[model samples]
Target: MTSSLRERRRQHLRDEILAAAQALIAERGYAAMSMEELAAQVGISKPTLYSHFSAKEELVIAMATQAMERLFAVVDDGDPPRRSALERLADLLRTGVQVQMDRQVTAMHLWMPEIVQMMKSRDESLTQLCRIDAVVVDLVRQAHLHGEIAAGLDESVVVRIFYALFMSPNVARLSLVNSPDPETMPDAVAHFFLRGVAAGKA
Candidate 1:
C-alpha cells in the first residue's frame, strides 16, 4: 500500500510539472521559461522537479517523446480500409502536422536545439526517430505498390523528399522569421506529397 501510494504521488507530481511547463511555454516562449519558474508554477520545490527529470533538456525530451507517441497513435488509429493508402497517408501526415502546429510547435521550436543534441547524445532517441522514418517510408512504398501513388516512383526518395518539405520551411520560419502560416501548410504539404514532385497533377 505504501509503495502504491508513493507511485501515485510520483505520477501526480510528474503530471503537475508537465502541465506547468506546458502552460509556461504557451505563455512565454520556450526559451524564456526557466526550470525554477516551472517548479514554482507546479507548487513543487526545485529538487522535487529534479527528482522527476534531471534537467530541463531531459524534461523537454520527455515532452517531445510524448508528443511523438501521440502522433503515432493518430496515424495508427486512422481508417485504413475505407481510404486508399495514398489518401490515408496524406490524411495522416496532414493531420499530424496540423496537430503539432496547433498544439506544440512553439514548444517544439524552443526545444529543437536541445532535442537535436539529445538525438545525437542518446542512441535510443535516434533509433526511435529512425523507426518513425521507416513508418513513413513503408507508407510510401505501400502506396506505390497499390497504385495509389505512381508506379516506378522511388519510395525512399519520395519519403525523404516529403519529410524535408514538411519539416524544413515551417520549422525554419518558426525559428528565423516568424510562426508559419498554419492555414496553408497542411494542404500544401499533402498536395505536394500526393502529386508528383515536379509541377504536375496531384
Candidate 2:
C-alpha cells in the first residue's frame, strides 16, 4: 500500500510538471520560456521541479512524448481498435490539431531544432513515429476498402493527402477565408478527407 501510494504521488507530480511545461511552451515557445517561471507556475520550488526533470530539455522531451502518448491512446482503445479505421484516423488528426491550438502553440514551436535532432537520434522514438505512420497508412487502405475514400486515387496519394490534412491546422492560421474553428475543424478535415474541398467541405 505504501509503495502504491508513493507511485501514485510520483505519477501525479510528473503529470503536473508535463502539463506546466506544455503550457509554458505553448504561451512563450520553448526557447523563450524559463525553467524558473515553469516552476513558479506549477507552485513548486526550482529544486522540486528539477527533481522531476533534471533539465529543461528533458522536461520538454517528456512533455512532447506524453502528448504523443495521448495521441496514440486515442487510437489504441481496443485490441482490434474500438473505432473504425477511418474514425480513428479522423480522431488522431482532430486531437493533434485541437491540442496545439487550445494550448496556443505551433507545431514548429513544439518541434524545435534540438528537440527534432534528439528525437531523430533516439531509435525508439523513430520506431514509434513509424508505427504511427503505418497505422495511419493501414487506415487509409481500410477507408478505400470501405468505399469511404475516393476511388481511382492512388492509395499512396490518399495516404499523403491524409498526412497533409493532419498539418492543415498549421496552414489554417494564415487563411483569410472561412477557416474552421477548433470545435469544428476535425469534422471539417474528415469531410475534406472523404470529399474534395471543392465538394463543399467546411
- The candidate maximizing TM-score is 2
lDDT scores in order: 0.70, 0.72
Deviating ranges (above 4 Å) for candidate 1 = 1-6, 78-82, 104-114, 151-153, 172-188, 196-202
Clash count for candidate 2 is 0
lDDT of 2 by residue, 1-202 (tens): 6999999998998899888788777688778888899889989999988898888878766655765777788777767766666667778877776665564454545545667577666687767667778888888788778766655677788778777887677677567987557787777777666555111233
lDDT for residue 13 in candidate 1, whole number 0-100: 83
Model 2 error, position 151 (Å): 2.9
Clashing residue pairs, backbone N/CA/C < 3 A, model 2: none
lDDT score, candidate 1 = 0.70
TM-score of 2: 0.78
> In every candidate, how many clashes are there?
0, 0
